[model samples]
Target: MATTGVITVSAVVLRNAAGSSVLTVRKRGTTSFMFPGGKPEPGETAAETLIRELEEELGVNLDPAALRPLGVFRAAAANETGFEVEATVFEHPTVPIGGPAAEIDEVRWLDLGLEIIPDDIAPLTALMLPALRADPRER
Candidate 1:
């Protein structure tokens, strides 16, 4: 049976220099691509969780200071049916290059310039696309 309830996680957006695209990842057994992040350990702050998750999933160690608040968002869980995701999202000041690690199966750059987001993205990724496009840094 599918698990139900809200999953609280810390996610990050790592954009290319042009900010036209962001990095996304797919877990080992999942189809949808979402921001690279995971659930926090007990008592971990949002930033702490993101920093640890980024390094674990992508092998990119991030400074806590480099994470910019990107606002909290909620969406349907991509891999877990009957559950929703509440993500405390952050944006890394600079894009980091890394490969799949831990439970990650693949990594890809998601183009923010597309008029339509691909169906394979998680709901949180879809929700953030418009905002990312309008960001001044993309200019």
Candidate 2:
């Protein structure tokens, strides 16, 4: 019998500061700028995963009460690894703390009008970019 695999659950945090958007750059081996998030551990909910990953990657703790679930999206693998992912996107008010954790190479606040976001991000995310640019809090 063939074994069925589980989908990886991740979150992409959308944080806006002073009318600018926040993004993180992974190491050279990874794809372009991405929101802070990662896979969910066993028995953990998506929201829990978002909170934990954000804190781990960005060094800022998000108030559980402040997380607003934007929506869920799925896309083909962005990296060479062929595993598909189901990403739960969220909009949150965040503040930068200390330096980013080891997983993150650099972090910056980008102009909402940035013209060169990577093409590997999900199509659904790209579709929402226009609206997000207009209102970062829009889910």
Candidate 3:
């Protein structure tokens, strides 16, 4: 059956060393940046989807056991008009290895403190900012 309306994605909110910034990526032709992840394959859990996507886009390998649940986030899809993304978010500590591969066009470590309204951004990213910046370690 074809899915409709909101698209669900699983994403990781990884922080760079010292936890000063969070990682975001712009896909192949998109300028807006968001957490790294994608839609799940049939029968796959959100964490499994994130593990697969991270490897494809960032050359990062992960043990599904390592991911910690953050929460579910929702906002308008960045590039897909008229749709929203319902993201199941996770947090992992390790920074990625080689990146900007596959559908990824750019890799950026944006400070959690940066204004949520950047020139170009995924709505999901904007929605997560306040919580990220509010984390005791981020302050």
Ranking by TM-score: 1, 3, 2
**Candidate 1 residues 53-90, lDDT tens each?**
88888999888877889899998889888999999999
For model 2, residues 55-118, the per-residue Cα lDDT tens digits are 7877778777888888887654444345555688777765655566757776655456778755
Each prediction's Cα lDDT score?
0.87, 0.63, 0.84
- For all candidates, the clash counts are 0, 0, 0
Strongest candidate by TM-score: 1
* lDDT at 117, model 1: 85
**lDDT winner among the candidates?**
1
lDDT of 2: 0.63
lDDT of 2 at 43: 92
Each candidate structure's TM-score, on Cα atoms with residue i matched to residue i, is 0.93, 0.75, 0.90
**lDDT at 138 for candidate 2?**
30
Q: What order do you get sorting by lDDT, best first?
A: 1, 3, 2
lDDT for model 3: 0.84
Candidate 3 ranges with C-alpha deviation above 4 Å: 1-4, 136-139
Pairing residues by index, what is the TM-score of model 2?
A: 0.75
